[model samples]
Target chain A: MGVNTSGAAAYWNLERYAERVAFVDEQGGICRYGQLQSQVDEFRDQLPQKRQLMVMVSRQTVPSLVAYLGLLQAGHPFLLLDEKTPAEQRADFIERFRPARLIDATGQTIESTLLDSGLDENPTALVEDLALLLPTSGSSGVAKWVMLSYDNLQSNAASICEYQAIVPEDRAITSLPMAYSYGLSVINTHLLAGASLALSSASMMERPFWEQLREQSVTHLAAVPFQYELMERLRFRQQDWPALRLLTQAGGRLSETLAKAYTRYACEQGKQFFLMYGQTEATARMAYLAAHREPEKVPAIGRAIPGGQILLADTEGELVTQAGQPGEIRYRGPNVMLGYARTAQDLVAPERPQELATGDLAVLDESGVYRVTGRLSRILKMQGRRIDLDDLQHTLAAEGWSLLVTGEDDRLLVCLTPGQNSEALLQSLAGHTGIHRAYCHVFERDAFPLTPNGKPDYAQLKRMQHESAA
Target chain B: MKAENQILNTLFTQSLGIPSDLVTEDLAYNSLPQWDSTAHLQLVMALENHFGITLETEDMLDMSSVAKARSILEKYGVEWV
Candidate 1:
């Protein structure tokens, strides 16, 4: 149960618990721990050594996990591309990463001029060796690949398992995209603990999704805030999912109302609801709210997982120890990534061995709970005024309104649910924040656009806003 | 007169939620504002439904630009003039 010194060795140890279930894909196919290991070995034998491989997979599929494990076992650094990424983006990725080969189960077959190198017969990676190159979700703009090591992933998985008290037989459902750090972490931690995974390709809105969860007896569910919004819209009742035992949400803040509602439902159902917060840089989860305490202390992202330390520092980088004071959330842990990948130059020099200065602004409450305010980089300056779009959106969301804010050509546009008084909402926001009306414009839509990962599609939103303004 | 062009026009308009007039043979998917990943999936489904043929995954990925889409559809036996 100590920190795994090697990815392959850790997996080998976990395979001893191979009699336990490992994964159940959307097609109801079951992969036991032993079977998963065999597939990983098989995939490793099929891969080339010392060359980059691009894994293109649907979110939460068994093949995706197998491919990742295989790449690690073979000591080949791999890039994970979400199936939902456009072909244009994939082409761009192929060119930039120059992956020697691509493995896809999503049926995407790309032919590129990139060199195809032969596979290695025997390859191995140490715990400290690079394991993966994951691209940041980049909901804002251009995506950057974050380099992660085997030790980074192993430490984070072990810490998560320790925090959750995950057991061998626990069953988890794959809800988020596996290409995402949050979703991939769920697989790594669960499998590390010899748990079972139920994969369902259906979206949250689909009828088959809930039915599959109930049928598969999914004990753990990982989701983002948008899916929780859909669950609320569906008015999912506690009695409907008696088999559900734990629910975790991350990848953006869950609204206070939905959090309270889900917490109450979990409480009534005698299930645990975990409010988790993390980023790709941390290799998944850094902080999690314990399941027993929900709704009453809802906004907090809870405490750090084992082996991780979260400290808040003011704008000047001085550590803030006082509760309720906002500062940049800096993380120091083995799980923090090495650094980001640069297209033009060699990888940026790694940050000081253990600490990562997360760009998020947050506060630690009296209970030692962390609540993210906004990203420091997300702040926009327009017409001599500074604005935090996240703050503006959060304020509107608190009042039962949903909006996506973007700036195009020096004009800030607020995209909200259609037919609501756009001007009035803007006026109210201005009244509350003292923002000038001329600098802000409001556009209404029936539904705000969302990425496949369930985050707001700000890139697409900005484009639309620009076209409309033109 | 080409089935490939018809497929492209229909998919572009229907999936991207753009007017038919806006879709041209030279119009790239990302060049238009509304044609994003989500819309791309919708476009794929539309193509499958319209052609009554299951698109190979490779072809689906290759259908990025309108011209690329026409070529891919031609491989599927949909003729393009």
Candidate 2:
């Protein structure tokens, strides 16, 4: 494979780098640069000629990757679907969007003939500008997609490459699902920098994951906090990696103890450990704490990524310059999504808002590093006063116990590790907030439930409460 | 219905949201998408409440399948008819 770097190339132009190695498979088979280009071209030929909305169940495979790239190059904006999406949900989205073509798991284009394509009626205007439609969160549906332009993807990838110093020599393994924004952004940034990727469908719990990662000589890796916990459970620290250069944590907040442990491990091993934070609205990366400042084990999410700006907005929507006063974390960046899609018609004419009001509450310390406090909506109203559920959970967390806080209007359910009594935790909550013990329900669980994305599925816990109540 | 099957049926349906028909001897954790870690927790909590037996951490983590859960319950002195 000949990787040509003769001129500046748009990261997505597969044809431009026809000679480089784009992906390495589990069997150690290499998919070269030109192969991806040819595959993209082949996929482009298979699509229906007319411009219509597309719904793709994005799987992590050579065919899926090439088809996605092909559709993007052909200027087809698509809604990426998780494979686990239920049949009824799929039918509902199909009915709502009336997508012209349905790209099945095998990369076959099936004529969705369910309804007349909705986007085709006013096709000329919106189809030209839209590039991608990602879910606002894990559970978002047809009515809610974060509309992204090619510009949004390109700018966010550029920002990531800048902060992380990604070069053409870098290669990252696919640790997250391709349907996820964070995982998709890894593909975007690496492609922008003309880097390579080693794709794997295996979970970290398997021995094959490490064997293949080593075989591919993967250089950089990123994961959610729960993955690190899994790695710890798997005794990953004892295993040595000679080629790995950068290790990053995102998707959710890692505990200070684990963050410090990984940071120390990275520092001692001469590798860079990055603590990052972002929301789906602002692409994948918004803020990153660099490795140079690794003396403290507890890392703060550093300043905004190069192309973005982070500010603290008070209750009145005013910027707070002074430190320690917490407010909603506000991010203004080019990568901020082009508004949201409620219907098929909403896809046209980029409606990107200037500022993204991140629902997370955070405060800038004296050193200008932002420490996320809690979420605005993760609050519980108890005794006629608003109580921060995260703050209450942190009380148990401070006691070095792993727990999950979830409940309804009047009570909060705290699920904790088995064999341990929640009496202390319950008393502490009552002592701090003046809420009665009756309002708190404590159950014993071995550990918190992890979602598909490797974050604690607090939403699932809430659903359990509702289901049990019903 | 057998004592074990009845207890397992209610646990699988009401607690884990598994279809009552799908709750069988062959049902395994992660064997189906619906029986993920979250469902596993719900099943564990429900089993504890119904059987009046608290599962330890090691036992909870090791409850991988319906057969496995039944075997573990037997070890806890849960008699099966």
Candidate 3:
């Protein structure tokens, strides 16, 4: 997709990283960067049209990536639908995007929905500067598209590689979904650095995942918090991976306990654990706490990534420079997304401001680290006092409990794991807040509802809480 | 044998947190969303707790389907019908 001239040039040179092992598939198929560029060239040649907006359902990592590059080469602004999106939601997105073509993993057009002659009178002109469109979950729990230019993708990849100290020798695995920005970032960074990747769609819950990791000898893998929880439940440390050198976590807040536990486990296994923080608006990563830091630093999102700057802004929009003061996180970087798009017309607009007001509230410590206190919306008013649910959840998670918190105006409801009995925690929560035990309730669930991006689905939890209360 | 079937049936449903009606003899791991890797571990734990026998890692890997679980448990003297 043709973007601003400087941004377009950044993406135009594909052969710069044309030779290196990109990754191995489950069937022992190896993909190289050179081969990847060649595949993109081949696929672009076979494309039915040029510079058309296409919606694609990703398949296995390698194939999905090839088509992604193919779209870039063909100058088509593409929307990558989450592979895990349910059929109904998938239908909703396809209907909304109104792409010229809907392509499956195998590069086959599922169907052609040719728009009216006047719709996007110049199809390619619509995205002359936009290259990627990612789905972001809005505050009200709806999927909204975020527009990213070629600069956003390349700069983010370069910035990630810098902080992570990724090299051509690194072998990262596809532990996360390719459709999501984090997973896609891993692929991009590795390919950009002439490194390698190991692709498997099998989840951490399956045995094949372990088998594939062992056979391929992946040097690193990225995971969200819940995937770490699942691994902990399965006694992940019981097995050793001699080949693993790094473990990265992001997508949501990982509890201090889990973070420390994994950090220790990685240390024991002679590996580094990277705790990262990001949003799709920032193109996946904003900050990352590296492995060599002290254990206390594990809870902090560390500093902004190499090229990015983090500043705290209060309600009046003044910068808060004093340490220990909490305010909204404001991030400034080239990796920030161009803008957001709720409708197709929005895709054609110019870039948004490079500064992102990351709605997460954070306090900067004396050590130049940013510790997220809670989201601006996560504060709860209880018994004439304000309580941050993120704080409550953090405390609970730090105490080795898997949980979610929801509430009404007058009461609070906390949900824990089905097998865990939190009677003591429940009693303490009631007493600590001066709220009567009757006003606070504790329940359990087998699993918390997760959004398509794998974070806890607060919308679903709220519905369930009210439905049960009623 | 009847007692063993009763025990296994209870174990599968309870461990996987699925309805008893859904725990058919042919029900396999990964067949249902609920029967994931964690559920498999839970099932193994329930089997160990109920039968008073520990399974090797290979046996755990082999325990993908209910029939396979039954067969493995029988080796540990579960005597399922």
Candidate 4:
């Protein structure tokens, strides 16, 4: 079984793994590599022969996995969107991008009307290297997509396999949405390593998710900070699933308290715990704290991954040579995205070397590990999903509410003037923004505190959150 | 509604930001968009605070619906009217 070792090599040569298990269904049925290749081939044959753009409603299902490989193998660069995306948002993307086809979660493919009308008749107009497009902001209803090439995917996958030392025997259970870069990386890196995956959409809150984890003998598990919180609440330490070996965390910073707790568990149980950091711009991960570093660097996001460099530069664009000085974390790597795409025409934008400015503030420890201090942007991640506060504020203002939105990683606090209905406003914000109402809190004040420049004093607002929360 | 049901209803309404009338016994986790995983966590925290009892992992995971929640609460000595 010689590896293809070329562009998009994983999907291009699924047969190389032969009878090894590729996917474990929710019911614990195994689909070997040979059968998976056949399924991808059948699906590829059904797709349009010409290279084109497609939109796929992605789920952590085996059929969706098959469609993904089929699309990649057929050379169709598709946009992967969450199944929970609003119908209006999907329709808006369709109207703006005019994708040639739409593949629903059930693996049903529907050709667009534009395909028959001869609009943009040549699909090859897109950049030859473009392989996938992922939405930059899922909750904001923004249509900006991160354009990724086959090289970007391959390099990142290979790098991840190198650090994690994933083997053919590892079986990962999908706990995150495949639409997300972190989740998609789990699929890509595992398949590239000839490892098997258990496709389950059940969340950590559900008993079935744990049942499947034990049933499938899943070895590798990936989660975000919020999911780690849930696993804590779920008393993951009490579980006796012996096969669980590797645990990876990303998507956002895990609180120091939780990080230490997991580190202790991994040490006691003799398992690996990796605290990683990345943005969608860098494919999936740029750095991970090696497990051997342990309790000493429990919360630090360790060194840059293989084939990548993690550098910190101050706001003046000078490298911060001294330790303990915070700077914007930057990553230069082959996994950097081709660029961003706001329109269909932007897909053809030429490729160039990219260095991702990760808009995050972190300081270097004496040992060269990076400890993230805070965010440079007005964004917060609740339940592993990034929410842009500015975008959310605009959405609220459009609906006749002007308030100060500020919060930590776990919750969103909005300061409102008195006489506003807090419950109604919170409900509307959650419903419109797809942020759960539980994470949205409201505080009332006669007038908001202002900075010297008359801008809403975000520092004061954040202070108010503690007083109100207590 | 019984006093127990009323207390439960108030907690669900305030925590989930849903109307009290929608918090019926048949209301289940993941059934209402508001009663999602995050909301469920909030509800559990609220229950622990109100009942003054920490729920174990099995107790939390087994609490799937309003009816199931009441039964689980009873195990912690919460009485129903």
Winning candidate number (lDDT): 4
Q: Which stretches of candidate 1 lie over 4 Å from their true place?
A: A1-14, A51-58, A106-113, A116-128, A139-141, A344-353, A379-470, B1-81
Q: Which is superior by TM-score, 1 or 3?
A: 3
lDDT tens digits, residue span A299-402, model 4: 89998999999899999999997999999998999989999888787876655556888888999988888988888888877666778888888888888886
Worst 10 residues of 2 chain A by lDDT: A1-10
Residue lDDT tens for model 3, A110-140: 5454532123567755757687788764111
Residue pairs in steric clash, candidate 4? none
Worst 10 residues of 1 chain A by lDDT: A118-127
Best by TM-score: 4
Ranking the candidates on TM-score from highest down gives 4, 3, 2, 1
Docking tier of model 1: it is: incorrect
Kindly give the stretch of ten consecutive residues in candidate 4 chain A with the minimal lDDT sum: A1-10
After superposition on all CA atoms, what RMSD does each candidate show versus the true structure?
12.8, 10.8, 9.5, 2.8
Q: Is candidate 1 or candidate 4 better by DockQ?
A: 4
Per-model TM against the reference: 0.68, 0.73, 0.77, 0.94
What is the C-alpha local distance difference test score of candidate 3? 0.74
Q: Give the true-structure RMSD of model 3.
A: 9.5
Pairs clashing in candidate 3? A2-A128, A3-A129, A22-A197, A23-A197
